[model samples]
Target chain A: MQATLIYGAGDVRVENVPDPVLREPTDAIVRVLRACVCGSDLWPYKSRAATEEGERIGHEFLGVVEDAGSQVSGLRRGDVVVAPFVWSDNTCDFCREGLQTSCRHGGLWGANGVDGGQGEAVRVPQADGTLVKLPVEEDSELLPSLLTLSDVYPTGNHCAVTAGVGPGTTVTVIGDGAVGLMAVLSARRLGAERIILMGRHQGRTDLGRDFGATDVVAERGDEGVEHVRQLTGGDGTHAVLECVGTRQAIETAFAVARDGGTVSRVGAPQYDEVPMGFGEFFRNLTLTGGVAPARAYIEELLPAILDGTLEPGRVFDRTVSLEQVPDGYRAMNDRAALKVLIRP
Target chain B: MQATLIYGAGDVRVENVPDPVLREPTDAIVRVLRACVCGSDLWPYKSRAATEEGERIGHEFLGVVEDAGSQVSGLRRGDVVVAPFVWSDNTCDFCREGLQTSCRHGGLWGANGVDGGQGEAVRVPQADGTLVKLPVEEDSELLPSLLTLSDVYPTGNHCAVTAGVGPGTTVTVIGDGAVGLMAVLSARRLGAERIILMGRHQGRTDLGRDFGATDVVAERGDEGVEHVRQLTGGDGTHAVLECVGTRQAIETAFAVARDGGTVSRVGAPQYDEVPMGFGEFFRNLTLTGGVAPARAYIEELLPAILDGTLEPGRVFDRTVSLEQVPDGYRAMNDRAALKVLIRP
Candidate 1:
């Protein structure tokens, strides 16, 4: 089998790896059909130090089950399914509360000796709890959208939902990445009346507009804040869906959030400290959103995607085979592609 | 008229001042019957540099309407009322959303030239919006509790309520001051199944127990984290009501907050930065709460106080005349008084 590995900064490779086997009573071996590079993966790609061997990378995938341990229930060989970014025992208290990302018995892909999603095969633990069966065919055009259920789409939904976006909500989405565009779509789906998409890239912002952004501001920092404020009648929006985790992004989110508004950060935070001082505090704002519990949302968001009401797959501008995984990483890092899809 | 003024660190004085007059069409003059020194007051009390003229102090009080401006409505002379720490036009969007602290036209007492609550008379801006008429007598025995409706009690309720306290919820209160004790009481009133109060003072802890703290942990920092962990089956509580503004308090709040739990902070944050790094983000925690919109909660919480179903005023452990306010500040700052009541 072939898999993606990170050797060092900007170093990505596809190499032969041993086939995955069920290691736990609840584990299952999955032959991945679809996977993609995540915005978070860029962090390690930019700063990870060199290593002699390599580290498994990628956390989003859709695949067909090849084998399942004896204890695995409700799934069998050839079952098409989507694996959430994190594996969780859905029966845990946190999982039951719809926060599978915080499940006590949960673990992430590509770490702790687990298989990375950007590979030919993955060893999925807690199979019954972590994988959601897809109703689509193996080669259905819907596969791309269904694959998004594995991470990206759910993450975007998490940002809007956590920020309390709903009917008549006015929202500002910072970032023109795939996740940010998906958030624009999610916010609109959740009935946001107005959305301001912040990004300097015309191409990506144009796609964001197609995803339901009513306004686009090609500004950064203070200028971006002013543009959002102007778009929102000088009061700012009711919620800010922050898809960029840098300090400047967070600052802009806080700055453009209306008094009593919420700022939900889905971007993996790059900084350690948050500026939630007396000013933000006095305004009575709420700070929420974290690692999206994709597993919990797959069931709720599936109907729309299956019915052709949502087309989140539009985020993928380029596609590559397992062998070209390294090229996909480079294209994404160079900002030449919004998101790259990988077929293993 | 006489009012409390802070001339410098550890320097409080009762001095003659011009009588308050209605300055706005919506303004009303309130003759304060009861006022209290708050924990926040002690902050400036300890560090405020000496000034020749002195600054107005105090923000909690219950009073009788002395006079009303020509355009003021729904309030008449002699109507007993409680003034929230901040004055707000209840009709503002933020106020309508139950976050009156962020009301567009709101202003804090003792700032922006508004009369302080510790004064013999207060010229309340936005009278109808800032003062909630009390059904009790001018000198009712429940005056202490009724007075609390102005700030302390509503603030505690804001902490618990913002943390989503409800039937069978588990909660941790990270302070034992009047507000923290009130939080314990508010959590109980909201039907929390269990409440853990962190405080070292025996007297205050005992009062907290009476206020509904099922368990008390006196330890701070690492030991405190372990103590709370042991209390909640090593998972911490569902919600943490942060009533102390110090860094240690915020850290403890996050440390003891269960994964997917909420930490609502009502304390006026003394620091500028919040430590919400990857660890907390991955836990899917929600950080909320701010300076309480007490006016919005007054009507909802007033009934309990009036019916003897709740007694938050027991937090007031000492009583002093207007002239002894300086002593009251010292006693509270010295840890000799849990809270002080002032009669002008």
Candidate 2:
């Protein structure tokens, strides 16, 4: 089977790989239908995260169950499904608490000899627990939106929910990437009264406006906070969604949040430490957010996608075949595309 | 008039000072009846937080209204009252949101020319908004407990409340100092099912038990987390109260919390930065806390203190006169007493 692999920094290729087979009583072999390059993938693409020989890439996918192990329940062969970026035995106490990312028996894709999502087929452990079954056909027009349920959309929702972005809340989203745009959509869905999108690119900010951002601030750092505060009548927004994990992004989130407000971040943290003392401590702000529990939120967000009420798939501005996965990475890294969808 | 002053690190003295008088239309002259040394005060006492010429110290006090400015309402001369550690004009939006510590017109005690609470008389800015009047007599036996409402007790309650400690939740409190012990009491008051107090001192842990600690973990860091996990059936506690502002205390608080749990800290943050990446981000944990809005909680906690239902003042194991106030600081610094009460 053809699969995406990264040999080293900036080196992505599609090559033949061994086919997947069910290895556990609760496992299922899933034939990939769609996969995508993620903002996080760029981290490894530009660092030493990739190997000299080769390493399976990607952790987001929508697929069809090709085969199922005996212990798998409520799911069978040929069924369409979405697997969260990480696989977990949903019955664990942590998973039961809606924190599948911290599940005791869970592991990340492409790590510890596990199968990566950007492949022709992959063996999914705890099949019934990790995969959310979709009633729609495998090739439905809603595939892109449903694919988002595997990662980005749920991550954006996590940011909004953690920031307490609800009715009448004034929100500031600190990124113009696909996840940040999705956060605008999620905040709108959650009934936020005002949404501010902060980004440097005019194209992405335009898309953000179409996705429900009432205002856009193209400034960075102190100037960005000033713009947000100016738009908010001198008091900053009530909630801030930090979709960019850089130190400046985090600082902007904190600065633009009103006293007693919250800053929820879902960006993969890039810095080791964040200052929480001095003025930050006395403002009564709440810092809440981490990795999104996509498995926990997918079921809740599925109906919106199926009913056509949400069009998160618009985030995918470009598409590629399995052999062109490298081009997808370059397109996103060079800002030529927001997100790239790959057909297997 | 007399007041406590700190000229330098390890230097505390009781000396004659000018009497306080109403300075603003919204101010009031408060005759302080009781004042106490706080854990946060130790920070300046041990470091260079004090000025060489001497600065007024102490921010916890219960007092009687000695005089009121023309605009002061709802408070009359001779009325007994408790002033929050920080003074604020309650009409601001931040105060209306129950975050008086962040009120637009608020300022910390001993800062920006504001009179500190340790003096014989304090000129309280925003008097009508910052002081909570009491129905009890000026010399009531409840003075000690009522004084706690000025700071530590409310600060502890803030920690418990921010951590979401409530019915059926298991809580772990780091630090056995006055604030930490008060957190145990606060958790119990909030109906926490089990309270674990972490400290190495037998004397403090014993008081912690008396304050409703169901378990005591004498270990620190990784071992402390292990003890808490073992007690919670290897799942960790539902909430953590970080009453010590050290990196180790913050780390332990995060380490012992179950997935989706909260860590609320009220201790003055001693470190500039905290690591929130790596494993911490994926745990789905919420870190929420800062300086306590003591004024916001004073009204709610006053009844309990007045009725003897809450004896937070028991933390003050030693008492001293204005002339012996220096000894109070020495006793607390040397760990000879948990807290020190001073009468002027």
Tens digit of per-residue lDDT, candidate 1, span A1-344: 89999999999999988988878999999999999999899999999999998989999999899999999998999999999999999998889989998888989898989988999999999999999998877888998899899889999999999999999999999999999998999999999999999998999999999999999999899888888887777889999999989999998999999988899999999889889989988888888999899999999999999999999999999999999998998899999999999988
Off by over 4 Å in 1: none
Candidate 2 regions with alpha-carbon error over 4 angstroms: A49-52, B49-52
What is the TM-score, restricted to chain A, for candidate 1? 0.99
Write the residue-wise lDDT of candidate 2 on B1-344 in tens digits: 89988888899888888888777899999998999899888888899555667888889988899899999988999999998898999998888988998888988888778877787988999998999988889778999998889889999999999888889999999999999999999999999999999999899999999999999999998888998999998878889999999988888888898877888889888888777774677777788888999989887887888778888888989998888988888889999989999888
Against the hidden reference, what TM-scores do the models get?
A: 0.99, 0.97
Q: Residue A92 of model 1: what lDDT?
A: 86
- DockQ of candidate 2, scored on C-alphas against the true complex (2 decimals): 0.78
DockQ of each model vs. true complex: 0.88, 0.78
Instruction: Give me candidate 2's TM-score against the actual structure.
Output: 0.97
lDDT of 2 by residue, A82-178 (tens): 9999999999877898889989899899878888888898889889899999988977999999999999999999999999999999999999999
lDDT of 1 by residue, B196-246 (tens): 999999999999999999999999999999999999999999999999999
